[model samples]
Target: MMTNAIIPLVYGLLIGKSNDDYNQFFEKLFEQDNFQPESIMTDYEGGTIKSVKEMLPNVLHKAVWRQVQSKGLATKYREDESFRLKVKKLIALAFLPVDDITTAFDLIVDEFDEEADDLLEYFGKTWIGEPKRRGTGRKKPPSDHKL
Candidate 1:
């Protein structure tokens, strides 16, 4: 297997991780030229997402992943083999073609136990915005391709 190292072309420090700060930083980075990136991968950070949407509207911006520990699922992920594998299956949904993702997500979630509901809810709300209250499709559905 091959691995890629992520190196930043531009780097800097910002006082805060708020939308304003990220907005300003992105603005500065792109203001000078019509530089458009093909896509951007960012951890699930609200401010960063907002900034990217505002600053680089045409570029594809994806929320890659949220921290498993932060979601209080680390223990399950560490010790419960079945739970861990299910979580990984959730993550693998990211690689599916955009049009097929909703269906694939439904199939994956059908296998999860009730204990994984919270994690599933978080993922559904964050990445797959549908199957919401009014639409009523059911629950809906991240990750490195090679993981």
Candidate 2:
């Protein structure tokens, strides 16, 4: 899998970090080397995710542990083994069958305490839509499991 591969194909300064910047970078990479990786990984950057989906629609997009840092859970992930495990469990939810993610997410979130409320809310809003102020069941999720 691309995740386990040893590859660092590019390193340079970016004028900015935006959907436009990433899009142009990817376009140039393709123009120069005709490069199109099987997959790309990111730290939960919205611009990167948007560009990857736009330019490399056929390629897989994966998120690494940097999600912890992005969500301000770095200290908790490092010091609290239980929270770390729960976070890993949440990440693991990505590998589950798409139809099964909601159930698995609910199961993992059940173990979270108030410390994880914001993280849970982040996940709920980003990957799975939260319940409405008034609803019988969950709203249709905003992000697909692929995210």
TM-score of 1: 0.47
Candidate 1 Cα lDDT to native: 0.66
Lowest-sum lDDT 10-residue window in model 1? 138-147
TM-score of each: 0.47, 0.52
Q: Tens digit of lDDT per residue, candidate 2, span 1-147? A: 467466767764578888899888888888875676865666567778778767775552244344567777788777998887787677666557777888788888899988778778877777766777885556777666665
List the RMSD of every prediction in angstroms: 11.7, 10.0
Task: Show model 2 residue runs off by greater than 4 Å.
Answer: 1-67
What TM value does model 2 have? 0.52
Per-residue lDDT tens digits for candidate 1, residues 52-113, read 76676544223323445666777877698887777766656655766776778788889987
Please report how far candidate 2 places residue 126 from its true position, in Å.
Answer: 0.6
